[model samples]
Target chain A: MDIKLDQILFQVLNFGVVFGAIVFLVYKPVIKVLDERAKKIHDADRAAEESLKEKDAIDELKKKEKVRAEKESAKMMEKAREQATELKKELTEKARAEIKLDKEKAMKSWELEKKGEHAAMRKEFVDAVYAVTEKVVGKAVDKKAHAGLIDKGLKELAQAM
Target chain B: MSAIQISISAEPIFHLGQFVVTNSMFTSVLVTALLIVFAVCANRAVTSTSKNSRFRILVEFIIESLQNLTTGVVGTGKRAHLFGPLIVSFFIFILVNNWAGLIPGVGSIGIWEHHGEENIFVPYFRAGTADLNMTIALALISVVLTQVFGYSFQKLKYFSKFINFSNPLNFFVGVLELVLEVAKIVSFAFRLFGNIFAGEVLLTVMTALVPLIIPMPFYGMELFVGFIQALVFSMLSLVFFNMATIGHGEEH
Candidate 1:
């Protein structure tokens, strides 16, 4: 094969021009866009992943909060129940004490009334005896021995009647 | 001349236009067509959720590897996006050209001829990178692109890299930079030419020497060497590009 310098040079120049033109016009620009796109895609993917992770964290936190809230609510309910039970017990005990006190007061008042009535009756009986004795004694005697003898006779007569 | 030797030596293939189309050319055309078809089909068949089919996987692997190499060396900022496609195309083209050499029809199934007692085999397809002219052209494009990007990116600074006249020392540095640029072209051309030519020669010699089992291992090695050489050439170009774009302060 015969080697030609001109032919070789022409071929080289031609190849260079073809490749250079394509690179300048199409390849380089396209690659640049693609690269930018890749960077954007990578950034977006990272953001999406971070958001997903954040969402998971939020979900977990919500779950924990819910559980905590439930526990707190339960504790409050139990406390309220305990207070109510305690209050109910106190009120019931107070009412029972008041009923027992009223019962004692009523019994004491009834006894006082009975005693007063009995005393009054006794006083009346005494008055009647005095009047009767006084009348018997007035007709006779002003002496102490005479009065004593008359009082004794009247007491015996009253008792026999 | 023996009849058996004449039969082996005198097979002539057809021609197309000015270019003599032989079996090697046929194989190369086939390979090129296959690549185009693959690109088209893969583009059409792409889906979001589906795993890439076998062919698509292979193509994506090739493209992604190229992209990764570019990004790794040049960093993901500045001109990586700009130079990625150029670098990828360079790699793919050279890789295809280099791999084409290993096909059965390459350097074989050629137009055979007679020259007295010796046989002359004219190959239909010369491995594109193996040709000095082709490699030189590719090198020029790579180096020129480096300059273009540097100019566009740094503008006045890029020009000042070789045209500084502020002081004697600066002038001398400028001259040195100019000299380095020229040297870059030479180095690029020679590096690719030498590696590819050597690989071709090695394959040829190996085939001629053993013709049988020995060539198989060398073929495998040649494939590996071709891949490495292509990688090295492209990587070196990328490094040069990175260096150029980064300006004179940073080491490559």
Candidate 2:
């Protein structure tokens, strides 16, 4: 029936001390470990996801590089083909010019050879006529015969012209 | 004309340190002893093979019920095994204590004492749970035990909660958490004290006003209230233990 405020306060303080001590010693640790375990798992999962994303990004970059390399190789091959075609055309042009020069030289040489053959044939004709005059005459004549022969050569030359 | 004064006196049955040890206390002690004996003898006879024994059945029922309850609340099988025994013991002991008060003449009988012109019937036997001191003691024990188990389970990391002074906001939050810890103790003590004390007062008033069959309904209500108070006390203790063992981020 006689409840004292001081006694109640004392009991409250006592309980608070006891409760605080136990909480500090016990409850906090248990809950801390539980939270730590949960957080660790969460962090690990996040790390794994990040790593997977990184790997995927690397893979995508690699794919892009491969595609780019293929395109670059195709462009280079096309340029090489174009250069080869140009080189082939230029070489053909040079060869054609050399062949034309050789043909012109051969034609000039043939013309000179024909002119020489004509000169030789004219000389042979003159020599034949002279031998025939000597045989026909069949005389051991001297200046008269030669003068006659010259006069005859002159006539024949005039007639032939 | 004559002036007459009458006096009546009653003798106390037992005494301890200026305080009378009553029948209710006797019942509490008996029940507590019986529970201990049952536990010891049952433990002695217990084997993995003894499945059908009555004591084993009783214990198993209690354990299984606690296990089921905790597991349902906590959503973990591991914690059920660890915290089950305390919860079960608290439930059974408080249940027994609450019910023990309901026995006839527990808080009813008293030693009638006269002082001056007043006759006060001081009760020799008051229900232990009905007393604020006993309920508060039990609540303190429960709350303290919860903290102890929580610390043991959490280990060194438990101190980080209070000692973390990294940021001003965090420091304030930690202080708030400390305040909450004190609040938890208060809540535990007051919840039990309020319920049990109210029940006792209610029963006393009912009986004082109506001495016959009128108090019967109230008595039955008291029995239900007693059971509910015990259940609530034990359940709250169990919940507090569960809460203590689980930190801020730890929930199902």
The most accurate candidate by DockQ is 1
B147-242, model 1: which lDDT tens digit per residue? Answer: 988888778788887887899999899899888888887787677767766766777777766678988888888788778878887898888787
Using TM-score as the measure, the top candidate is 1
- Candidate 2 runs further than 4 Å off: A1-161, B1-27, B37-59, B75-78, B115-117
Please give the distance, in angstroms, between residue A35's alpha carbon in candidate 2 and its true position after superposition.
Answer: 30
Q: Chain A alone, TM-score for each of the models?
A: 0.48, 0.47
Q: Which residue pairs in candidate 2 collide?
A: A26-B150, A26-B151, A27-B150, A27-B151, A28-B158, A29-B154, A29-B158, A30-B154
Against the true structure, candidate 2 has what lDDT? 0.63
iRMS, all models: 6.5, 10.2
| Model 1 regions more than 4 Å off | A1-161, B1-34, B47-51, B114-119, B166-173, B250-252
TM-scores of the candidates in the order shown = 0.63, 0.52
C-alpha local distance difference test of each model: 0.67, 0.63
